[model samples]
Target chain A: MLILECPCCGVSGEETEFHAGGEAHLKRHSVGSTDDQFEEYLFMRENPHGVHFERWRHNNGCGKWFHAARCTTTLEVFGTYCAQTYEPPKEIKDAISARRPGWSWRNFS
Target chain B: MFEAVSALQGASFNAGIAEVRELGLRGMITLRGDLTDKKLIKAVKGIAGRIPEPRTVALKDDDGAAWMSPDELLLMVPHADVLSTIETLNASLKGTHFLAANVSDARAVFEVFGPHAREVMAKLAPVDFSPDAFKMGMFRRSRLAQVPAAFWMNEEDAFTVVCFRSVAEYMFDLLSIAAQAGSEVDAL
Candidate 1:
């Protein structure tokens, strides 16, 4: 079991109590961006093999949503923070805020 | 057609007393939304006729209790009242930002009562069940055997344990384990 550190609670808990969000720091494109740019934005994900920041829900515990920075290769969590306030990758954020088709928080936030 | 299941069978553990017979419990509804949503607040108030006072569980005229959470609440009412409650809520809600779903059938509840019930729960859950910490008319989101569950403690040493129906059987097994643990503790 992965021991996740909650930035809010300041405690490390089992991964079952938490959920993995996704790559952090997505950039939003400028308005009137082309379809190719939009497609690239939609399909491209930072497949980082090392430390990555993602959102994890403490659903079984505080029932509060938070973010976790962890290593996908090792399942080693580096840090955590609240989800809403956690900064997202500029591209992903722009796509999400733009309300573009295929852009979603569920797949990447 | 419905029968009351004992604590060891399917009883809800209360905090103040040993036990009280519960015929059937209300369906459990988990309402999730931003606490600052005025429209959501208005809708909930309209349906339940005012949310339960802060930190306190108040029942509707029909014996439904709305237990508040940090960002949401767990509402308990008779299964029969669920449909009407949802309809009234839908009519009152102004936006689609809020999500309200009836989870009564999704959860299995067991009422565990008795003076020792609290003690039994302390061993099972990580939260403080003492009156000061848990008190009367408070709800908690906690884990049982690492499974998500909502706990509502009412007066008379009575508490209701609600969890997903899929894990209800597992929780039941844990309760039996807790009861046996209680029994063992008593022996020593």
Candidate 2:
């Protein structure tokens, strides 16, 4: 039973209470964009073994969707933050880096 | 017969282990807005007598105000007063970026009252219903045996569970089975 603490509702519960959305922090492709860009945006996902970011909804709790930084291999969740932001918050990045010394996610190092 | 009838219609089971009854014709108003906004809070307070905190419920007589999500609140008022409540809310927060809808008939509410109420709930949901963790006024939207339901405890051994009107029968069937003979074990 994987547990996630919801940033919006402040309730921590098992995976049954949440819905997982694979791979976070991807650039959205829109109309008039290159075919390759559009295809990548629609189908591409980074299932990295080490540090990774994700989108999750506290579906059974707050009904809010948020982002989480976790290790794909170890399943070690560093932290969760607001989904409204374009990128992971600095604190979440710092938390990931503290555990994974050389790890980086998407645009944030 | 053009009269509206309750989903349960006085049908109950489990030999009084846990009694179930429908709260018929409840007036539900779905309010969506920024809870932190003073105007919104004041407007909600005007109807519910208090602003509910996150995952918390405030009860004033038969009226219940619950925080459904970060930006959503559910107000349960008397069936007769629903229209007036909506009008008052619209007048109160006239220019706010909010959505208010009357959802009275959209769902059905079942009240579970008995000593084994929490135990029966624990059998269906993945949440912990122990006194220390899940206590009074804590409202949560969770699945009860794959049916999306929301519940809140107003008394120590009593709770109110709501689900879509379409699935009320399925929900009752599941609960009835769970409350049947030999279901009351010491632990799950």
Best by lDDT: 2
Stretches of candidate 1 off by over 4 Å are A1-16, A19-55, A62-64, A68-80, A86-109, B1-25, B47-49, B52-62, B65-71, B94-96, B181-188
lDDT by residue (tens digit), candidate 2, B40-104: 99988877899998888888998878988889999999977989999998888898888889988
| Residue A96 Cα positional deviation in candidate 1, in Å, after optimal superposition | 31
Query: What's the lDDT for all of these models?
Result: 0.61, 0.84
TM-score of chain A of 1: 0.58
Candidate 1's displacement at residue B166, Å, is: 2.3
Error of 1 at B106 (Å): 1.5
* Cα lDDT tens digits for candidate 1, A29-55: 558998877876677776666555666
Q: What is every candidate's C-alpha DockQ against the true complex, given to 2 decimals?
A: 0.20, 0.71
Lowest summed lDDT window (length 10), candidate 2 chain A: A100-109
